[model samples]
Target chain A: MNEPILRIRNIESFYGPIMAIRGVSLDVHPGQIVSILGANGAGKTTLMKTVSGVMDPEKGRITFDGQQIQGSEPHKVVQKGIVHVPEGREVFPLLTVDENLSLGAYTLSDKGQIDHDRDLVFSYFPVLKERRGQEAGTLSGGQQQMLAIGRGLMANPRIMLLDEPSLGLSPLLVQEIFGILKRLNDEQKMTMMLVEQNANAALELAHHGYVMEIGRIVMDGAADVLLQSEDIQNFYLGVQEEGARENRRWKRKKTWR
Target chain B: MDNAQLLISGLANGCVYGLIALGFVLIYKATEAVNFAQGDFMMLGAFVTIGLTNTEYMGLPFWLALPISLMIMGALGYLIDRLIIRRLFGESQTAVVILTIALGFVIRFAAGLIWGHEPQTLQNPLAGKEIRFGGLVLGMEDVAVIVVTILLTWGLYVFFSKTKLGLAMQGASQNQLAAYYMGIPVKRVQGFIWALAGVVAGIAGILFAAKGSVDPTTGLLGIKAFAAAVIGGFGSLPGALAGGLIVGVIEPFASRYVAAGYSQIAPYALLLAVLIFRPHGLFSQVRVKKV
Candidate 1:
């Protein structure tokens, strides 16, 4: 759709001998938030890692802006404008917040432009500006997540692959982070591919959603349709009164017997 | 030699050790792997200077020859990084260590073949001049060594703390993957560091040879430098210099008061004690990794 900005065709990834993702295919268009919803160990992180060039796919092609980039180095991938904010917020602990932000713009040649971006990032996450002199490790989970996002922004990426930005955060922080993500998508028109276990939040934010189970896509549709589907209601939301009533009847019959 | 004269000689030797140890610390910080060939690089630099000064091909003055040798050695370091060390990037720590050791042997043998086995003296402008302070006598050559070491150390402190490139190098040293993501050309920074380390080692070699003789066997001095690095804290820059000083001061004292052979063993013993007590060294900052 609309000349997919990133196209993943039949990607299979392995960790040594064990296959992590099998025949996984996905597409992301410009200026859209596409979410892959799955439980833990369902290849969500693996897919993100593969797309980011941290992990090499054994089979299939990854075409970014119509150019093959299946086995490129991670830094080269960043240069081509696909910045991955990896899971668990892997910020350099010892480096100051400002240093971390500066590192994010490592690829940009213009110092003036980088400084502008730095100011822009601080505006987006004002708390980072207040704590710019502090070591990154000293930041709380929510702040670290914000710093990670700000760092990604410094890269000036065309597309951002965010792997569970809300992980290990308080509910309040999660809401705030999601709000920022929405703002980034609407105001900046930033394209994002988000992998998250927060199914409800993910469905609410994503334009389109793919439901993954056991390393394969089980359901793919508009987020609203997926949210309203009987299958999803039964499996994820546990809204099956009919099944519960039948289970009680069966229990009664067994007791009588 | 009297106690005061021994102290002067010891401090002079310590300054040389400190300089070489500085190189070890710099390269190790940038690459996270000890370049075992560091000593051989110093040997090469000294011989390069000797060649330029002695041969009619260059006929350059000692001052000109020194910088030229440093440049040549720096180029050699850059080449080594491009041709060899870069290939070993992201390899296991053990593999990198072994690779550098192999590189050291190659450098040593190469220097031996090129410069021949004979020991040669580098002519110094103040070879015989000594300044006596009360009971203590200090040679002009020793003074040069102390001054140069102090200046270089100060320069390096400013470089790491105040400069952008230095900060980038420090960032790379601490977390290379993160540094790469930030847009630092990690490879280029590493190459620059290796070249810089070579220049430091070269300066140490010239200073050392100014006081004594230079030969292929001089590369073995790296072992003492390595000892200094271990004593300092493998990762600490200041620690390397202090470690060098300790080794320098202790060796002469041990030889005089203890036994002649004991001086050689003193550094190793100090290294062992440090490892057992403070594994990070006296000055190195502790780094904790998240699981």
Candidate 2:
């Protein structure tokens, strides 16, 4: 019943002459974790890009916290308290971890507040604090991802768009990271829109879930509903049964186009 | 006076080359574009200083005219980024490289038209003065050059590591897209970097003019500085100074011991040798881009 913090309505995005996303609509309410699950080339990443103002959509509207922000640049979008932890964990390689964290608070001028927020980040990722003086490229993959998320947190964002935090991590590490994310959301009331291919882990953590196929949302409902559905189990969950494989494939194939 | 004196003089000249090389590395770091017009900017700075101080031109005194010329070149640098360089965003690397080379010629010819082709001496407070110690003698200007170069290099080092704005510029230079996502105004930073490069080049130009004379062809000195940058690991700040000193010392020593013609090609030969052996230069840290 809570009002949505971010609302998307029939948004279409294109790369050159090819359409990357079409009529993709979703909602993220206050303090809720919403996950978008899709395979490669299904436009999941493109949706996050459009929402974070990295690319302009050709049609429809994107409203973040009740303001129209469809075509704004990434820096302007960040000013509105929408921090994006982009895919591949793009940390500045040559910079020290401390320098990276300091840059995250670029908009803020208050030294005291910046220091306080940096300490908070250090608390969340103790490894970052210990390796603060080391170059960011020296950190392991898991630590770099943590630093990327921590950098996003330093901005004091109202909402975070996380793209594949567990892209190349071990299963145990994925669970560990998702556990931290859940605790942060519960304790600090942080809103998140996660794009993921790991449906089981994502659905276990997120409150709401949307299934994307070929640049459009195919099914969306409460996380439990989507997780329990028989179709998601066969295709996305990869727990396919011999009896239903052919019928499900034909039905899903028809719905795709 | 002797071979030792020649070495000392060569080292002093190397400091000037290093200053100009710093200008090249500054613009290259910020925008990833090798500015071919860097030497031309230095040439233009000297001409501007001379014109401002010339009684026939603006008639201002040397002290008053120098600062004004620096300001003018700084503004010119900012305008170059805004009016020309920005349009080449996302262009092919070759196109941008060629454009800058072409721009260097344009500025050089424009100076030729305005100032005439004749060489003119630049008036300065330290002209023709030297200090004698034992059998060795050093020009006052050489001492000034060495002292000023050290101070400028130290100042730049502190600015990059300590100050907020300088850190922001460093961060942006490393990754502009990431910097933008962090809410750093990257375009404005690019403009500031270009202006800063211009001011540094102006200082080097003024010093070079005072060392001898300014002519339209003076900008060709940028080529030697460019060779120094390549030897120093193009993006390394301190490497620029080291490379310049190496090039400067080698030129005079080669002419004195080897052949008179060897002076002109010594830096180029050293650059080639370095590129063949260690392409990244001695002090450069090799960076691998991650996906």
Fnat for the candidates in order: 0.31, 0.52
Minimum summed lDDT over a 10-residue window in model 2 chain A is located at A248-257
Q: What is the lDDT of every predicted structure here?
A: 0.84, 0.88
**Residue by residue across A1-257, what tens digits does model 1's lDDT show?**
59999999999999889888888888898998999987788889989888878789999999999999997777788899999887878787777999888778877778898988899888789999999999887888889899989999999899999989989888888889999999999988999999988777887888888877667887788888988976666555556646445334322232210
Q: How large is the C-alpha RMSD of every model relative to the true structure?
A: 4.7, 2.1
Q: Is the docking of candidate 2 incorrect, acceptable, medium or high quality?
A: medium
- The candidate maximizing DockQ is 2
lDDT of 2: 0.88
lDDT digits (tens) for residues B1-291 of candidate 1: 497788878888998888888888998888878887788787878888877886533567888888889998888888888898899877887888888788778877887888788898777577889887787678899888888889998998898766778878888887776676655678899999988898898888898888888898798899998898888988888999998888999999998899999999998998899999988887786755442
What's the DockQ of model 1? Answer: 0.34
All models, DockQ values? 0.34, 0.60
lDDT of 2 by residue, A196-244 (tens): 9999999999999999988999989999999998778867897766654
Model 2 agreement with the true structure over B238-267: per-residue lDDT tens digits: 888788889999999999999999999999
Stretches of candidate 1 above 4 Å error? A230-257, B1-11, B55-58, B89-91, B129-137, B161-164, B256-261
